[model samples]
Target: MDIFERKPVNHAIHTSPSNDLRLVESAIPDIQPHECLIHVRATGICGSDVHFWKHGHIGDMVVTGDNGLGHESAGVVLKVGADVTKFKPGDRVALECGIPCSKPTCYFCRTGQYNACPDVVFFSTPPHHGTLRRYHAHPEAWLHHLPDNLSFEEGSLLEPLTVALAGIDRSGLRLADPIVICGAGPIGLVTLLAANAAGAEPIVITDLDEGRLAKAKELVPRVRPVKAALGEDAKGFAGRIVSELGQEAKLVMECTGVEASIHAGIYSARFGGSVFVIGVGKDMLTFPFMHLSSREIDLRFQYRYHDIYPKSISVAAAGLVDLKPLVSHRFQLEDGIKAFETASNPASKAIKVQIVDE
Candidate 1:
């Protein structure tokens, strides 16, 4: 062990079914041989984290036990396994939120569909702990090294960026394809960038938050933002799209996961266009499938990524996408609870909140 090895410490946050939250310090997790210990440098609190805090259980999988939840993360390599060769101490890296089963024959595992692996362990979800700690340990292969130019905060976002990449990749987006992205949250903006990178000619975004909508416009000026209000009817959504862009979009990537937004994306997509569902909302949504079918809309689901980290890093490094602008709030490792609460608040106008380990 390194003479300066920091002792692992525990920290936790609890979320009630109705959205109440509490912060506490607990015990540290152990590092296994195939794993590496990472002193988390920065982690972004995802919408799912807020959902768990607010709704307790999303669908059938409820977080019945105590666990650290922040998953969109970046950290420094504190210790590497004896046989590890890809990385070493001091390497800045990002952690993929999901952990797949090691068993190769598990259908999804054998097909590189690890995200669907039945035995996968993920942070803050039930029995599995998370990286929101003084130290976190995970298998070495799951870690992705970050470039020198990317800040820890930006590095922590590889997960979201990769999600955007996967969405665009699956959409079969090509040069000059126009896109309409619903919801201008971090994922929405990231998906816009992914679409922009994939040669999608015109990228339009829709959101209820004007500030977030503006940020999306500022970052990617070509990305037109359609501001709307939260309402039961689709009038706000439909009016904004028609007035702003003047035509139906060929691609609609739904990042909001809200029932209304999902319906809007389904309606907005032109005939034979695609809709990539990148956000997580109610598991069961009431839908008008006949209309979507008539439009020949191809609905795609965005799960956690497979092997897009290296490309995400490269895209950030190449300046094809610079995510630093999205991170508007930050906190130290000791103040994770406060960070998550801030992240959960829509009024905070928060884009991204990072937990700094240092």
Candidate 2:
């Protein structure tokens, strides 16, 4: 241990049973041989975090008292344990949210599908505390050193960026492919960037919120933006997308987990085209599965991500995509409650609310 180590006190933002967030001080963690302690600098509030705050659960992950809430994070290393060679104190880094079982016998790990490992432990999900804290200790293997070109806020975005990349990767999108992306949330916006990076052109992006669509257009002027009217059914939106783009898109990446949006993406894809679903929504959705067979529309689902941190970092460092526009709001560590309040309110026009430790 460094003789001059800072006093081992940490503060974490966690949710209570009443769906309110509170900050509490706790002991800083001791690093394992393969781990490092990070002084968290920035973390973005994800849609799933909002779900957990509003409903106290997402899927099966419940936010009990002990559950700290945040997963997207970046920080500076405070300490590195013995035997750790990849990083040391003062290194800036981004955290990969999922930690999988390292056991070689684990089927998913051996198959290079570690994200699907049955015994995986993900941050801010149910029993696991997350990265919304003053300090955190994480495995060195899961941490990616951030280059000087990327800000801490941009580094935190790598988690969502990887999701967008995974969607494109899953779709097997070809260059210049006509694509439609539903939901102009963070994931959708990043998907637009990923598509642009992949050489996809004349992409159409749809959103119920005209503000979000306008923001998307501002970011990517070449994108075709379509605003879905209120009460517009999936079929109706599909027709609008076809009319806007002059033909069904070759691929539709559904970033909104809403049932109607999912249906629209599926219905809007060209015959034999693929639809990649990247959002997390309700478990059961009423869908016309039979239509898929007649049109040969390939429906693919994506989980979090695989080994994509390095690529995401490189993409940001190269300036291929600018992620700074997505962060429309920022809050200090002391303003935890207000931060969640603003993030949960659509009226706030908050695209991505970041909590920063000053």
Clashing pairs in 1: none
User: Which candidate number would show the highest TM-score if scored against the true structure?
Assistant: 2
Q: TM per model?
A: 0.93, 0.96
Candidate 1 weakest lDDT stretch, 10 residues: 2-11
What lDDT score goes with residue 16 in model 2?
59
State the lDDT of candidate 2 residue by residue for 1-358, as single tens digits. Answer: 6522653457788875698778878678888999998989999999988888788887766776767889999999989989799998999999997999989999999998999998988989878898998889999989999999999999999989999998888788898889999999999999999998998876999998999999999989999999987778879889989888788889999998988888888889889999888988896787779988899998889988898888899989999989999999999977877888999898999899999985
Q: Tell me the tens digit of each residue's lDDT in model 1 across 1-358.
A: 6423554455555554445666666655567778887877788888888777777776776867664577888888878887678889989888886888869679998897788898988776765666666677878988888888998888888778988887777778889887888999989988877777778767789998889889888888887888767664674576667556667778888998888998888777788887788889887888768977887988878877777888899999898988888888988767777787788787788898887866
Let me know the TM-score candidate 1 reaches against the reference structure.
0.93
lDDT score, residue 120, model 2?
Answer: 89
Where is model 2 more than 4 Å wrong at Cα?
1-9
